[model samples]
Target chain A: MSLQPLACIIPPDLLAAVAREADATQRQALLDTLQLDQSFRVVRAENAARTVETTRALTPRVGAGTPSRSIYDQKHSTATTPGTLARSEGQAPVADVSVNQAYDNFGYTYKLYWDIFHRDSIDDQGLPIEGLVHFGANYDNAFWDGAGHMFFGDGDGQMLTDTTKGIDVVGHELTHGVTQHEANLTYSGQSGALNESVSDVFGSLVKQYHLGQDVATADWLIGADIVGPQLAPALRSMKAPGTANHYDNQPATMDGYVHTTSDNGGVHTNSGIPNHAFYVIATTIGGNAWEAAGQIWYDTLVDPRLRPNATFSKFAALTLRSARTRYGASSNEAAAVKTGWDEVKVRVR
Target chain B: MNLPGSTGDPSGLPDPAHPRDMSDAGLHVTYRRSGGIAGLDLVAECAGSDLPQDHARVARDLLDAPADEPGRGGTEREAAVVPAGADRFTYTVHITDGTRHRTLTWSEGAVPSAAEPLLASLGGLATPQRAP
Candidate 1:
């Protein structure tokens, strides 16, 4: 059979004209080729923009506190990390949507910390943020690898989708690095649950700040976008714990604390208790969550009084102290914090 | 074919609570994965004869390997400590072959290179377990 001319060489207008006169099968083929060609043009444009942004990223900055971010493609292998650098700080979007999302989310998280808390990166030392995406084949998880890097997996498409698609998921993983630098909360028992809760709190705040959403407008659902057909809605809901999905067993109050050794003493399950407290506090304070409720939580995270093994009650007390210290003893913020703990059945001294 | 005394549940997964410890028997492997952002508990199992030949060999070798074998990417101390990152999965594997049996557990960060393929294969078969 004689070879047909390459579709890439044909103009779209000519292709459309030819398709109109062709048989049904040939017409469908031409249409698919045209769509593919259009996608290639879009990708080419994105690559050009990426080149410009990469150049800008390489230029020296006047400020020292700017975020230094890098994203890597794992190529569906879990053998090693920080695999192939796909993008860097200030770089334009790349062909891979996952890389672009990770890069943008990192910037959002950095902006929140710097603009609101004046904290530099995860370490407050302007440490570089590294993210790895497409980790493992059909991998369904994301994590902070204690070693200062973040890893995300392409979900199995049944229960979970792309982990990088969720901005809060990115924030949640990165907050683990923040927690590491500060409280370094032990990842077991109440302390472990507290660690998980802190990540959720800041993760939700990052989403809220990025969207410019107030407490009333925010959905307060974590992993909402990442979930798939098998698990709908979300992984967890700070506003109403235990109601996010079929498997969500999060308890909204200390009275319902789960007693188990699995999942690091049910860290993800029991985090609902503290997560609800933060939600209540933020909603009660009646404004932008990051401005008041977030501030108190952030203060407690970095406070010297916050121990590595802090319990729910201990963390509650510290939040009350933080609110009082920052917003005055009689301020509504402190009272809101106190009320949050009380509602969660966590007695603060 | 099922093992001589095989009593797997309807899904072919051996009962977790009453796993057989028979000596000089066919290969049996059980894998449990937990944690992650969704906080799911997933488990899978397969008899050696049911697995691909290469996977069965690897599973048998894993059962024969020493728990403290070097080059597994993590020491005993590291295994005991909580991994630094959030929403990462923790894995546990139990393997049994003729005259050999071993159980190994590790977080995502400490997974051995040799276990990757086997884990991936088994993870594909995993089903979420309802909370007890």
Candidate 2:
């Protein structure tokens, strides 16, 4: 099956909302974002034909899991050519806010994987983190193009600010890189939903880790900052699915599971099912989310048994097994894992 | 005999949500495309009478062309390849001439390249409306 590279932080539904509310100029920018996304998708499909080794080739192993970072200035253009390197691994802060934010966020993402997962960069191959900021004129999205590059857009300044403003957004896009390397989940149906959910989980985890907030303290909002003020409250709420908008209406369980051909079988919407599940697991374990609950979910992700086309229940089962394996079957961690799926109405068996 | 997964009868084929059959002549077509993360649409309307001689000829030819089966066609395939992480805009082409009317919607990448000029003209006319 043909797979598409994971693309963009802002959900299309919200962008649609923005487009609806926007003036002509802003509306054009929204449409341009949609067009850019399509162009990137095409580029990813073309890139897939390249040899695996060529695409996955590791960067020179940075000694000791230290991040190898490269920040580029797109200068309000959509081109991917990292316009004049603004900063490198050991460089000082740049004058541009977008450049600096991109640099710092890449470091934070690298730190999360290294400190918590004992993994290096995206591929765990000590890959260099590459970021392109200020892409397009008021571009309204960010994406990781299956390859090792991340691109951020300057929002329309009303519903969205700068794509780099959300650290979780950075974590979210980079985790797509991680998922691409590991499971390479098929980007459609249930498997696609799993791919999106995994990114959101780790994205939230990275933010929580950076803020030193446990499950109770963390906001648990995915793209809250990036969505701006006037639009819906948050992008996606793990604690409360479908709270983004009445139209979002993401069900937290199989009972409300959406079966549609759009959004890769409602990957963003149905993801609420698993997102709510993870939230329950973390809240129940009741400490730093990245510790017990986070570890279980991460373990489940890298588990050998997990298939690329895994359904929601299939993923839930893997988490349960990971919990049982890491912390005995009767342990609170394992029980919490079960309750997480149970609350979302996803069968763990 | 219709079998599961069989690519047999055209009617038996799984049609897209809103399928349009433009077999009738003298119909006007309005094409709206929505896909990608923005979930915004590019809305364009074209009528036989509104177009100049050359553009009108192409519009008539395109409208008269055989429509694909109900499932996502060219544009949907292009957009759907990535799955649901983003909104792959679906294209809805509604054709009416006051008598008979039909509506068809498809995702990006599934839209035919031939529809490019037609959509461009309409998109040029469109002001980037939000998807309903």
Top candidate when judged by DockQ against the true structure: 1
* Predicted structure 2: lDDT: 0.69
Task: Please give, for residues A74-94, the per-residue lDDT of candidate 2 as tens digits.
Answer: 887756567878899999897
Model 2 chain A — which ten-residue stretch has the worst lDDT?
A49-58
User: Candidate 2: where are CA atoms >4 Å away?
Assistant: A1-62, B1-80, B83-132
Interface RMSD for every prediction, one decimal? 7.0, 11.9
Q: Candidate 1 lDDT (Cα, whole model)?
A: 0.80
List model 2 lDDT by residue over B9-73, tens digit each.
Answer: 22322235323334434658676644333323346665655434444444555444555533424
Q: Give me the displacement of residue A111 in model 2, in angstroms.
A: 0.8
> lDDT values of the candidates?
0.80, 0.69
Q: Tell me how many clashing residue pairs each candidate has.
A: 1, 23
**The best candidate in terms of TM-score:** 1
Q: What is the TM-score of each candidate against the true structure?
A: 0.77, 0.70
C-alpha positional error of residue A59 in candidate 1 after TM-score superposition, expressed in Å: 23
* Model 1 misplacement above 4 A: A1-65, B1-28, B46-49, B53-79, B95-102
Cα misplacement distance, residue A19 of candidate 2 (Å): 74
